[model samples]
Target: MPDTPHLAAQPALSIFYQLLQFRDQRRKGGGMEAIATTLTEQDMRDIAAHYATLPAPAPQTGGDAQKIARGQQIAQQQYCSSCHGAQLQGQKHVPRLSGQSHAYFVTQLRNLRSGARADMDGTMASAARSLTDEEIEAMAAYARSLP
Candidate 1:
């Protein structure tokens, strides 16, 4: 199984929306549905707020240089920063991509590409559509290397 996402320092709005999706059965996996189903709106909000106040996850190291570079190139070409922020730290409703676990990132990307994941506005699905398996791996490598 892929690792759970590191939610610390993620935007509260993003977390809140994701929780709503899980609670409503829009986004599935990681047993979040079961957990979210028990949360009231206020409970979700408080959870989001709490996670947002925590520090970001530490940067991962030892990624392949070439793969990271290719991923950076792909990210730029994809205009990821337009919604994700300059450093991929995420915007109001965009989850932070930096410092994500490689396995988790790749799985989510694959899920988005396969239409198995729920994209809030279809943007993530659109963005992920053209990515090849190699590209996804490289992108995950890049994301894991960020601080």
Candidate 2:
């Protein structure tokens, strides 16, 4: 059972609970580190199914072209379009960034840059780590302006 009821609404929190359970078990004589090293096929399947149920985000639009163009240059140089989509519609597994709240985007980017958030591909973390504070601000601003 979760320590807090609010966590019940978050599947990721449940996953983290399971991970903690595995870690605790490993500390004992359970010795299942190898098995706990990665997610099982069932775990992956369940997560994918849950992820598919997420509602599609609403579109957002409008921003200065010059600012967006500068952001686009940074994005292109970073090859962000390869995963985020040329139009910022987002691709498989990559979360929709366009239309996301600027503050949220900036926070997540900072998390990735600071190693506070574990990016699946390591590419994002590396890319974020290379970005200056100004670049992150610009990217977040541009992403928030996309439709």
The most accurate candidate by TM-score is 1
lDDT of each: 0.90, 0.61
RMSD of each: 1.1, 8.7
Task: Evaluate residue 88 in candidate 1 and report its C-alpha lDDT on the 0 to 100 scale.
Answer: 83
TM-score of every candidate relative to the true structure? 0.96, 0.60
lDDT per residue for candidate 2 within 1-147, as digits (tens), equals: 111111111234333434444544522212444555576656744754564456544444666667667778888999888877886656554555665667667776887898775655587788788898888878877876766
Position 36, candidate 2: lDDT = 57
Model 2 scores a TM of 0.60
* List of clashing residue pairs for candidate 1: none
Output the TM-score of candidate 1. Answer: 0.96
